[model samples]
Each structure stands twice: as C-alpha cells, then as structure tokens.
Target: MPTSPAPLAPLDQLPIRGLTSGDLTACADLSEDRGWPREEHKWNLLLTAGMGYGIDDPAGKGLIAACVVTSYGPGLAAIGMVLVAERYARRGVGRRLMRHVLAEAGDTPLTLHATPNGKPLYEQLGFVETGRAEMVSGRFTPTEPAPGIPTRPATAEDLQAILRLDTEIFGLDRTPMITRLPAFADELRVAEEDGEITGFAAAWPNMDTHVIGPLIARDTATAQSLVASLAAATDRPLRTDIDVRHTSLLTWLKANGLDSIAFNAVMVRSLPGLPGDWTRRFAPLTVAAG
Candidate 1:
C-alpha cells in the first residue's frame, strides 16, 4: 500500500535556515515533485552563485519549502527555484520563503519570470509586470553560415572577454554564475571580429530538448550567427526563452523554424536598472536566472 505523507507543521512554527550544499538533493527532489526542469547541476550552479533558504518539516525529516535569490552586481537580483512540497501547499510556506528572500534582496530591484500560478503571489508582494518572455522550440535546420564574423568554440582564455560583453548587455556582472556555465553547456560558441570577442551563446541539454540561451551579441547579424552555430551543433529539438521586446528577432526565430510554446510575465518589484543598450540581449540565460 502507498503511504500517506506526514502532516505538515503549522506555518508559523516551521523553522527556516540557510540552505547548504547538503540540501541540494532535497531541493532537487522538491523541484522534481513540482514538475520543474531543474537538474542537480543546475541547482549546484544556483547555490554557488546565490543564497538560498528552506523550511524543514516539523519532524525534521526533510524540506517542505525552499527559495533562492541571485544577485548580479549591485543593481539587480533574480528570485527563483521557489518550491513547496504538495503536502504543505496553501499553508503560507511559499509566502514565508519569498519574504525571506526579498529581505535578503535588500534595496536592489528584483525580477522573476512568473507563471500564472505564481503571478498572484508576486503581485501581492509588490511585483508588477514589466514585459513578456516566450519559450520557443522546434526541430532546427541550420541556416547558411554567417559571414564576416569568425566563430569558434569558447575556451578558458575567452571567459574574461565573454564576461565583459555579457556584463555590458545584461546590465550586471554575473561572472560568478556565467563562469560556471561552460561545465554544464554542451557547447559554448563565441563570435569574434578582428580577434576580439563580440558575443557568445550556449546550448545545454534539458530533458528531451536542448536549450540555447544567453545569446548576447552586438547586432542582429552576430546574434543570428551564434544561434545558427548552436542549432547546427545539435540534432535534438532546441528551445530558448526570448524577450518579446525584440520583434525582429522574434520574427527571424519563427522564420527559422522554432515556434512559441509558452509565455511568462517578467515581473519586477522596483525600477529596473537595465542597461541603456539592451538590444544585444537576444535571449536571457533563463527566465529563472534572469
């Protein structure tokens, strides 16, 4: 016979503590139970670059809720990985974890890609919709290779240049998190001009589909080159979450074979400190890590 889960403790009495490496498995399990796409390596990257908190069951057997807040430079922070065990749902556990992370965010403006279910909670906490991001995926047919911009696989030597370009476009220094990407990415491609790195993109395996993202470039042509390179490298269906603000880019992506599968609101709690020039951000690293 299947066993019933133990009843949760009262919300007010649940103890919260800083999440550590020891909690990675439990946290991954929490996300898996909720049908989220995160794997252990992704959880490890988040934990390494940000701070997290969790609430344990009253009996101290395991976690019932958890959240993470990743800061980029001093101007922006992203809140993600919010999860609550089904047995503990509707008991204020989500709110408590969110509040804890918000306090940790301090004075920086915060952003999150909110699903319909999470939008209401975020709205109650002062978040307002700023924009929309759409997830697009499909079988990709490689376009004719881009010309004039030399392209090659990224190496350790290229990390510093890539970080600078990413910081300029992302409006914050995400070196800590970005530095860890190569280890998880199936391929990291860089675009160069006159031996100077101008842009880059990465493709990582996600379940059955491969995800390509953080595609930053100085212009549409360069962005297209990076995307095409990534698409050609993988035979599996490819997916990416792109900001809808770039109409031309969206149109081009559609013309290239990918189709929009899902959309989410980009919500912010304060004035967004985005760079004056964000045209280079063809796609975000991920809605969660934005």
Candidate 2:
C-alpha cells in the first residue's frame, strides 16, 4: 500500500523574507513545478522595480512557497508575477504575502493580470474584473521574403528608438523594462525603414511558456509581421497578455488556430484618476487623467 501523506497545515505562520537571485531561482523552479511559466526576468524585474517577498518553511530550508511583488512607476505600478507553490495552497500563505505587498504599494492604486484561481481572493481584497482576454498559440509562417522593410536584432544603439515606439504604442514610457532589457529576455527584434526604427518585440524563454510582449508597430501590417517573425524565432508557442479591446489582433490570432486556454482580470485598487486618452477611446474607465 502507498504511504499516507502528511496533512498540510496553515502556512500563515510561515516567515517571509526579501529575495535574491539565488533564492529567486529556487522560487522560479517552484513556479515551473506548478505548471506556471518560470520567468526569472519577471522576478528580477519585480525586485528591481519595488519589492519582493518569499515565504519559507519552519526549518529554514528556503523552500519558496509564495511570492507577491510589483514593478515600479513614477505614480503607477504593476503588481505582477504573484505565485504560490501548490503544496501550500489554501493555507493562508497567499493572504499573508498579499497583506505585505499591498501595504508596500502605499496610496498608489496598483494594477495586475489575475488568474482565475486568484480572482476570488483578489476580489475579496477589492480587485475587480476589467475584462477577459485570450493567450493565443500558433506556429508562424515565414515572411515570404519581402523587401518592403528591413529587420535586424535590436542593439543598445536602438534603445532610444525602441523606447519611442513603445511609448507611442503603449502610451507610456516603458523605460524600466528597457533599462534591464539585456537580462530579461533572450531576443529583441527591430524593424527599420529609412534608417528609422518603427517597430520592436521582446521574447523571453520560460519553463512553462514562451512569453512575448509589447509588440509595437507603426501599422497593423508591421504588427502582424512582427508577431509572425517572433513566433518563428521561438522554440515554444508565443504567449501574450493582451487587453480585450484588441479586436483585430484577437481575430488574427483566432484565425491562426491559436487557443484561448485562460482568462485574467485587469484590475486596480481605489483608482483615484483615470486615463483620459484610453478612456476616451475605450469606455467604462473614467474620472481624472492619470
């Protein structure tokens, strides 16, 4: 007969501490073991951004059970990469970590991409749904050898151009992600025309999924082409967390036979001001300009 397993106890009593690359690696392994993407860049980015906390066992073995943290902004913050080990589920580790991280957020209302398992807990903490999105997956068809524009691996020289394009598309300066770009991802692609950079994409290798993001293009054609090229370059399916408002992108993804296997909430806590440009084009968000 199989041996009976030890019953899990409340993890609330566990101690938490700041993280380092060594401990961060172990924590990432725990995330991968639970079938989540093991993005070390995500961890380091959060640490560099603001704060990160990891829960430990009573014996001090440093078995990372839970983590909650965010990336910084002058006035805005993105609460991301919240993960907990499966063995410690429903044991209060999440609540404890959340209490600590949220407190660190101060009066700055935070935003995050929330998983289904996390919705209930976050809702109880005042997080609500903004909308639903699909993370599509598909293989890319080679770009048929076009001569309209030139593509090349992005370099430090192109950092200014990349930042400009990203800010134009995202309506925000994503300098933080760019600042640590070298350590965060394996590859970055830039599209150039007339000696000016117009588009870019970043791809990070992960244990569970290949995360690609912030695909900014001067036009839809470039966007589609960049997506195809990035997908072709990866060993795994490309993953992205997109807003529901991206209809054209969604339709193209779905047509390519990519599956929407999960959903997440775009939430904020006590948002004092709203984004005028975004809300004007996309409703259900209002008040003052952030």
> Root-mean-square deviation of each candidate, in angstroms?
3.6, 6.3
Candidate 1: list runs displaced more than 4 Å: 1-8, 59-61, 143-149
For candidate 1, give the lDDT of residue 138.
92
TM-score for each predicted model, relative to the true structure:
0.89, 0.78
On TM-score, the leading prediction is: 1
User: Model 1 over residues 119-183: C-alpha lDDT tens digits?
Assistant: 99999999999888888899876443354466789999999999888877787788888997898
Look at candidate 2 and give me any clashing residue pairs.
none
Q: What is the lDDT of residue 13 in candidate 2?
A: 59
Our model 1 lands, by Cα RMSD against the true structure, at: 3.6
Stretches of candidate 2 exceeding 4 Å from the true structure: 1-13, 41-45, 48-50, 142-150, 168-172, 193-196, 272-290
Tens digits of lDDT, candidate 2, 1-290: 99887665456656677876667777778778679766675665555654667777654455646554544354456666667777766777777888877887777666666778887888888776665545565543342422345567888899887777555554555576565665676777877888998777667665555566656666555656666676667667666654567677666666664557666666667674322233112111000011
